[model samples]
Target: MTLNHFDDQFEDSPQAHDAERAEDLFVLLSCYLDGEVTPEERKQAERLLACDSEARQIYQQLSCISSGVQLMPVAENPVSAEETTAKVFARMRQQRQRRLAWGGTAIAAMFVAAVSGLSPHLGPNNQQFAHTPAPVSEDIGNLAPSETEPRSEQPLNREDITSRALFIE
Candidate 1:
């Protein structure tokens, strides 16, 4: 196997343990800078930062990153709250007017369709309807009455009603 430039003879050295500790220290430094660490953790990070060059370097990098992010621009809308609200309401009104216009147009189209469909029967020259009433004969009063018809306009009693009543068992 080809050995790299930094390769050393020792396989079981303290470098691996130090690398893990450095990673933990980086996290501790980041938390400390963000003010997320507790009092005990803050003291631990401070002690590490004071004694360890790697921890101090990580803290400096984290500090720079945090400050750089804070310096970045966050866009703030220029329009006033009232203006934005008015614009939104205006858009809504426009939509409502459009819907109403479409609905009215649909109703008018349906009305025209109905009128066109029924035009043949409702035309001026159609002979289905008659203006004058049908002629009635004068002999209607003189015609003979059936058994179901009343003989006279006399007031009916219980006995008279029994004569015409059909009973079901």
Candidate 2:
């Protein structure tokens, strides 16, 4: 058969008259209440309500259930003020302890760096090097090349060194 004939047959079928078919009317009514039903569904629901009192009653019952479900009281657990305060205090203490630990680690790192910097200067092995005497003038003379030998001329002094010193007469 053609599509139109099949639609007519389905509409006239015994199954379509069953109470289970009222569920469609309930769904349409819920969508209507929620402002979501399409124009075609709204027209179909109106036609059903005008033609079938049972379908209309079912739609009304579903709408009431929807509204009732939305209005029902929700249960909430009771929390005391003292309990909330204690929770806040505990969180603050945890944060404070973390900050103190990080600060202490930074301070310890700085101290280690300071000690490392001073270690080479103050170490026991460095004492002998620090106390060693200056080389004898004759030994320094032996190590130097002869000053009478030809060498590059020194750059002239830009300023006299004695000019910086003040001697009171």
Candidate 3:
């Protein structure tokens, strides 16, 4: 229906401010035509159709359209309900399988990293770098006080340790 015609039709009704009621009447009419309206809505629709010529015309038009749609032929290749359900379930199954595959790949990658010593910790309190041997030079080894000598109270020189570390010797 044209907007102009609909506006004119709405304007002709004395209860123009009651747009909500008009919408309810249209819903009632639709439900009635489909034989699905409650008794109260059916009574209201019938009363409106009897009193208002415009409402009666709209109801007639809707009824005619509903009948026309119902009379149309079915599609040439209609899929049955069971086939549609099967396709939907199959799609869901494929999605679940793909998700499982991705999860398994992530788990395998973490396991490989841990086994190859690339991970930060192999086990609790077991760091990868903790067991690595520090490089030592023969010069520093010789300068260390002999364990066989008498013990002394003096501390070792800090300068020598700093220079040895900085120069990698």
Candidate 4:
């Protein structure tokens, strides 16, 4: 069947949006095998594997790769968690330093502008802020009920509310 037919089936189902999300996560089945997937992603992958033959085949392929990796001998130079964290922090520090270097130039430029009296209010071309007026339309003007219309001054009772109830309407 075409995607349109599948879409029609989804439109008929209450869980249509959920099914679409699950289908989107089908590619993440490999991530599920790696323990890198979120709980929602795992659920979607499982649902897809249970129903889709193509997904099942891809899952089997990914499982084989995982099993193959497990069969290999442990690495002699296995990096510790602390070492990984340190390297990540080092990289972050380098990025922060680069950002600060660029930010310093901007700060210097702003200081020069302030010292040279080129600030917004001090500039010769400075203009007062203006408020734009809202557009006037007949539709908007007619929306409010006129004082000429007769309005019921009576307070609504339980019977009136029950007779013309919220959801019943």
Candidate 5:
């Protein structure tokens, strides 16, 4: 109850020193109960429990406390195991759907942004963009053989190709 009450346990001994020894003995007894002591330490604990009635009483009290803890009521879950599993799976599916939707939207946004950003640069000043290639037709036989030397540095226009290409029959 008080320091003086514990102090009266040992005659002519300092209270702090005796208190520390009592705590050490109690911890040793607890470790022995939990089967955590080494073989040498176990022998020491067994000797202490055999010789001291106080150590034996403390060990018995600790055993009762431990067994009482095991007997305490366990909290019950409100949901059934099946319902919990179904809810977890449903959440995973929802998250997957959201990710897929976000990924597809991000790809489409990037494509639109890229096309819009480059459109202004694709004018007559940009020679690569200015020259529009002739559209391919499924009727391959109606196509004309390329007349200009493919290696020629000269630029040809639609006017230049009038003699060879897509003549109205």
Candidate 6:
């Protein structure tokens, strides 16, 4: 009935009845009570329950405690329905603010992309400048003098002279 009675039952071997072991069992029981225990641990606990009467009784007592703890009524808020609605509205407003912030960021990114895409066509000043055709120059005479009509026949090997001329230039 009492935790002390449960404590006394396992006092012969205090090491066997470690608080940590009980706490581990309590956690397992909590998971079991919530229907969240793994299949393996659940099977092990069930096997232990089948073989040991004391273990079963202790489990039953703990189960009673668990159920009692779970069934205890939670405290209700003192706030009126209007106040609750106000809190809900405030939360909605905060959520909307967050969404708006993300939306603004997306819009800014899109605007930047649009501007960058248009940059080459828009020129340096972001203004559309027309492509003007370059003016063509009138024909000019040959800048170099004619070789055959020249006076100095200094036995110029033309190929070697041209190659040397290219390097000299």
| C-alpha lDDT of candidate 5 relative to the true structure | 0.81
Q: In candidate 6, residue 11 scores what lDDT?
A: 74
Q: What is the lDDT of residue 120 in candidate 3?
A: 41
Candidate No. with top lDDT: 5
Model 5 misplaced regions, further than 4 Å: 1-13, 78-169
The TM-scores, one per candidate, come to 0.38, 0.33, 0.43, 0.30, 0.38, 0.32
Tell me model 2's lDDT, rounded to 2 decimals. Answer: 0.76
Per-model CA lDDT versus the true structure: 0.80, 0.76, 0.80, 0.79, 0.81, 0.73
Scored by lDDT, model 6 comes in at: 0.73
| Candidate 1: regions farther than 4 A off | 1-13, 78-169
For residues 1-169, what per-residue lDDT tens digits would candidate 6 score against the true structure?
8999877776757786676567666666666667888999898777767896655766888889877998999879678899999999999999999999999999999998888777775445556435433433454554456676767867878775554442311
> Of 2 and 6, which scores higher on TM-score?
2
> Which consecutive 10 residues in model 1 have the weakest lDDT in total?
4-13
Compared with the true structure, the alpha-carbon lDDT of candidate 3 equals 0.80
- Candidate 2 ranges with C-alpha deviation above 4 Å: 1-20, 75-169
Local accuracy of candidate 1 as per-residue lDDT tens digits, 64-168: 999999999977967889999999999999999999999999999999888876797665566663334334457886467678876798777876565555543
Tell me the tens digit of each residue's lDDT in model 4 across 9-80: 878886886566556555598788788889988898789889988788778887898899899999899999
| Runs of candidate 6 exceeding 4 Å displacement | 1-20, 74-169
Candidate 3 — which residues are off by over 4 angstroms? 1-28, 35-51, 71-73, 118-169
lDDT tens string, model 3, 1-169? 9999999988788788567666766778888898998888888888989998867877998989998999999899999999999999999999999999999999999888777675344545553432324456668667777989888888889875665553311
Per-residue lDDT value at 80 in model 5 = 82
Residue 38 deviation, candidate 3, in Å?
Answer: 10
